[model samples]
Target: MMRPVQEICFFVSCGVFLLHGCGRHPLEVDISDIEETVHVERFDRELFEMKMDTADHAIGYFYERYGDFFDIFNTHIIHIGPGSGKRYPSFLSMFINDPANREVYEYTGRVFSDMEEINRCLTNGFRHYLYHYPDSTLPRVVGYVSRFNQGLFTVGHFIGVGLDQYLGSDCHYYDLMGIPRYLSKNKIPEKIPVDVLYAWATQIYPYNDSVDNLLTRIIHQGMLHHFVDAMFPQLEDSLKMGFTGEQLTWCRKNEAQMWTHLVEKKLLFSTDPLVIRKLLEDAPYTYYFTGESPGRAAVWLGRQIVREFVRRNPDLPLGVLMSRRDYQEILRESRYDP
Candidate 1:
């Protein structure tokens, strides 16, 4: 949807932060701590390499092979530039640099791993739908990985949720779905038309049971869902309009039904930088700030939090509000410092 002018201002501030070297730091954990040996047979490696050579060919190959089982969103792909490889490392370093994030990341990783295992079991029993119908037009899996990396930056820098902290709220889902919805509603199409792009990002295949189910699963597995729900009362009124609880529930349930197939195939799990490009390109919402970076979202959210805090506690000084440690403790305690 149309972003408020304040949001634009917030975006500008985030740009300044980045320029000032205030970007999220990387985690201090050694690569060996989280790295897994990715095994691909010689034939698999050859095929994967061939697919990577041409983006169009890779998209087409995936769609031809698995289009039937999944609904491919027509999201734009971000082309990875030469220096972009450092982005993830940079993001991780932020976690390592911040004591709060380090604590949160440890907990979050364990929770995510647990959820992944459960999802693996569910997929094994039901079969992944994305594997059955891959779409050629769909963004590559690597693209998703990149988006996740950016997500880390936003969550860490703005929310200050430690790495181990489970979002434990519906906020994550609200963000995942809301950002795109806002982008689509605002008519800010990437290179592609907004409607076409929205259709792709929100498209559901036959495998997903319903949007409600999808929401339920996401909430059950991730902590962010709870956070979203907590802020819903405040944000919904401020935004002027948004989905009601019932509507969101219905949409999420239906979404789950539609995407079950894709989830089964593991198409949703990606780490490519191209995914971020596609998301921004296809976003329907515009920020007050101008830039191609995903940090804009974090800035917007940070501003919102600041505004809310000020409104609730008019007597509080701005200096205390900006204190990272104090603010983080408040967030961790689930209380507004104001």
Candidate 2:
């Protein structure tokens, strides 16, 4: 939450000056000495290996190993009801027996057979997290194949990453499942850590604003992306923002024009859910902009605003940057004026 406010405000200032973030940037520091690491549990492999013959033992084993997440996955994710309910075994069996689920799980093995690289990346990312917020509890990461039901999800201190969802954009399964090109193109291994940290950032510092407006929503989204930036400093903005290389280039070239459109059209403070969705949601492009622009283009501006805010306030710790909730005050402080 605090991190995102920093992200949101980073844009307010950056957006004003043709996305030039004159403010303090999130420092890229040496984290080689940080000992923190994250290891993802292979829950997907374990779940797929469950056999009815060993039902009693396996059931107990899952309960002991995964605890609340076991029940949550059963109820909230796969939607098979509570884990301990009488019909739970039958439902789980049905899921395991499903041909489609089996196909997806098997395919996941081919793509993620070795998770060492992923573990190393996450370790480095969390090292940054520890560097910034030493008091926070690092969430346990559990890797699972959800038959494309979830890309990433969080409850309490565990983060579930759906292996099936990140099986590369060109995976035939996506075409088979009718996944849109714009969406599926981002389903690559490189995006996993960024997506994971972003999800965790949202959970730790959720959108806590009292009023819902376009500016607030855009700033919140920008802050979330900034949190990801802090965690993974080297990640490309296009990947972090889920835009194509060309799309990102377009955003930079037209930053001022986009900001002007928002101002002249008087859309910044508007709270219409439709307007929010059109600007923030995934689509081929932002309907408000030329077809050459990418979806959620406004958010790109938000990121610039926050980047500037953080840049200008170099001395402010990340926690303080994110803790700032006054979106308007952030804007005023950012001095963002496209």
Candidate 3:
């Protein structure tokens, strides 16, 4: 966890503070004294509210608030040109004036009219993040309209969330866009914190190993999930794993069988990208497992191994666990018989 972007993990080893309560789990710590909170800026609203009469000042203020991210939003996110271009105002006007984008923006507004619940959720999770890394700053979260381009994106210290991508699984737009039901299952308000924390966790502990084998990647996935668990101790495993309750149950009931398959098939150490994708990508179900199993079911096993590793090694700090690179050694010591 001592990487460049993770330089903020100054006290990550000291195990500073966490959110503890009466009858709280041991994984949680006391964070009542931490006065920090997360404030999410609505970039979508500001973009839509930009009127022609006062477009110049509105653009100026938006630029001030978003700065470099403005260009990122336009070029990378919305597929528009750079925000600093001379024709940027016209580009923004075109986006605002487009009837289709307008519809999406209106729908997003109706769905996310009240962000209080989400703000509070982010604050609590980030508070735990801050508690562990006292020197880190809470990421500046901004909500935007990605027109179904992406669900979320992280750059530098800013996190962007697309309101349109999360307008309920049954939203007509998703149907119109031809999104699969299994993929759309995660398009809900509740997945925001989980998604955000996972994105941040990747940044905190990016996978840089040149050896991209199945075991290496699988354990990395486990480490990321473990980090998210530490940030939100009370969160349901289904939400964290992006699995339906039934899918999670299937994973639990067949954990041993799945482990046997991986080892018996000699697929645990395969470096084939296609094999890795089959095991890890989001789909109806993991190709290697039955249809009843969840996509990335192998990752669930990875998390279990990591959980066992941490459980067996009580004195190991979270930072150390995450910083670890010897995936095979970690798996061996995990003693994860199940």
TM-score for each model = 0.22, 0.91, 0.91
Native-referenced Cα lDDT, model 3: 0.82
Candidate 1 RMSD computed on C-alpha atoms after optimal superposition onto the true structure = 22.7
Query: What C-alpha lDDT values do all the predictions have?
Result: 0.27, 0.81, 0.82
Q: Which residue pairs show backbone clashes in model 3?
A: 18-29, 20-29
Residue 190, model 3: lDDT of 71
Decide which is better by TM-score, 1 or 2.
2
* Model 1 TM-score, all chains together: 0.22
| Per-candidate RMSD, Å | 22.7, 8.3, 8.5
Cα error of candidate 2 at position 131, Å: 0.3
Supply candidate 3's per-residue lDDT for 160.
86
Tell me the tens digit of each residue's lDDT in model 2 across 1-338: 01111111111111121223466445676778888779789998898888788877898999898887787788878999987789888888999888878877877876777777678778878888988898888889998877888788888888888888887777777887899998998987767787889999888889887788989888888888888888877666776888988999999999999999988899999889999899989998998999999989988988888887887887888888888788878877888876
Best of the two (2, 3) by lDDT:
3
Per residue, candidate 1 scores C-alpha lDDT tens digits across 172-238 of 4225545444332321101111112112222321112232232222212122211222212112221
Clash count for each candidate, listed in order shown = 89, 22, 2
